[model samples]
Target: MDHAETITLADGARIATWTRAGPAEAPHVVLLHGGPGLWDYLEPLAGLIGDEATTHRYDQRGCGASSPSDEQSVARSVADLDELRAHWELDRFVPIGHSFGATLALAYAAAYPERVPAVGYVSGVGIGDWRTPFRNERRRRAEPFAARLAELSVPQRTADEEVKWRTLTWATDYADLTIGLRAASAMAHSPHVINQHANRAVSFTDADQIGWAAAVRCPVYVVHGTADPRPAANALQLADRLARPRKRVVTEAGHLPWIEQPEQLRELLAEIVQAGRC
Candidate 1:
C-alpha cells in the first residue's frame, strides 16, 4: 500500500482509505470489499494491479479502522464513496466490488452513471431474491459441519456465539476446508462489528431498489466461482441485465475468489481498468 488516511465525512463519520501508487496518469480504480461491514481485504489483490492503475481501497463507515456510525445504509455508503472520489479529485473511475460490495457498486453506478467508466463484480450477491437460494445452498453444504457443531454443544445465542457459528459455517464457502479454517482464523482476530441497524434499513424487494442494470451506462465484468454456494445462475442473470457485461466463471474456486484464484482476479481487474481507459 502506498499510503493510508482517514477522511472525515461531512456528517462527522470518518472513513479509513488506502491508495496504492501507480502511474500518475493511470485511470483510478476503487475497490469495494464485501460484508456490508467488512474492511478492505482486497489490499493484496490491489497490489497485484498497482502497476497498471492507481488502485484504492477503503473500510466502509463503521468497518475496519473507520470510526463507527449509526448511519450505515446503502445510500450513506454511496454518499461516502462520492465524498472519497472528490477528496481524491477523481472525475470518474472504475469501481470493483466483491459480494455485498458488488451490490453497492451497482447501486452507486446506477445513482451516478456519469462517474463510473465500468464495473467489475466478483462473487457478487445479485438481485434481492438471491437470499433464499444462497441460504439453501449454504445450509446444504454446511449440514455436516452444523451437526458437528451441534454435537459440541456450541450455543448460538450471544454475539460471540453467533460469530463462532458463522466462522465455522464459512467452511461451506470454500472448496477446501483448510482454506476455510485459515480464513476463519484470520477473521477471529478482527472485530466483526457489523452494523445491524444499517443492514435492516436497506430493503432489496425489487431489482430497482438500487439502480436497475439497464440504467448502468458502463461495461460490467461479472466473475463468479463455480463452487461458490451462491448460485452461479445469479451471476449469469446479472450479466444479462447489464447493458454491457462480460462473465467469467472459475471452476475450482468458491465465494472468495481472491483467496482461491488471485491471478484470475488480478487479470479481470486489469481488464476492467484497461477497458475503462479506452
Candidate 2:
C-alpha cells in the first residue's frame, strides 16, 4: 500500500486505486481482481510479488470507494485502464487478471496491444459455453448451503446477510471446504452491492473471445486451479488461441490460486512481469 488514490476518469467515473512499490528497475504489473462488481481484493497478491515488480490494483467503477455509476461497458473499462496507465506514466505493463478481470485484461490488450507487454490470465471463463458446467459443478458443491443461500438471494439483504450469502455462494470455489466459508466471508467486504450492469457489460461472446485472442500480440500466461469449479479446459482453449502463450494447471488449488498456492502463483507472475521488460 505504498500509494492509494482515486483516479477520476474523463467520463466522470472515479476509480479507487492502490500501488505497491517494488524494485525501481522492475517492470510494472497490474493486478485485476475478479468480479466486475466486487471491490479490489488483490492486496495480498501485490505484497507477494512486491519484491519483483511494482503492482497496481483498483476497485472497478461503481465498486468500493469508486464513484457509483451505471454507465458500464467494456470500452469504458478499457479507457479507464489506459487513463490509469497514462497517469502512472508507464510505457507498458503486464496485466494479471483473475476471473472476469481476465477477460477484461484480454479486451484491453486487444484494444491497445502496444501498451501491454504481456497478460496473466487466472481462473478466467474462457471462450464458448462454460457457464453451464460451472453452474452445475458449483450447485453440486454448494448443496449443503443451498437452502440458506437461496433465502439470502433476495434483492434486498442486510449487511450480515450479504456476507453470509456471499460466503455460502462462494463456498464451493475452494478446494478445501473447511476453510472455504471463512475465506469467502473475509472477502465479502464493504460496498456489498454487485453491479449487475457492469457484470453484463464485460461478458464476451465466442466471436469476441476469438477476435480478441487473435488481436492480442503479446504473450499470455494462463493459469487455472485444478479444483476450481470453473473448468480449466476453457483456459487451455484460450491459451491455444494466443500467438505466444504459456499455460499451467495447479493441482489441488481453487479458483483463487493466490490464496491456495501463493508461492507458485507468485513465481508465475514474477516471470510474466519480468517478461514485460523485454
Number of clashing pairs per prediction, in order: 0, 0
- Residue-wise lDDT of candidate 1 within 1-278, one digit each (tens)? 46888899898988888898888889999999987756778887787786888988999888878888877677788899999999999999899888888877888898899999888888887654677988898777767677765644543346666566657777778877678778865764466565556566644544563345888978888889988888888677777878788888777888987687778777877888898796
Question: Taking the tens digit of each residue's C-alpha lDDT, what string does model 2 give over 159-194?
Answer: 888888888888789998777878887887555577
Steric clash count of candidate 1: 0
Off by over 4 Å in 1: 148-163
Q: After superposition, how far is residue 142 of candidate 2 from its true place, in Å?
A: 0.9
| lDDT, candidate 2, at 33 | 75
The TM-score between candidate 1 and the true structure equals: 0.90
Against the true structure, whose TM-score is highest?
2
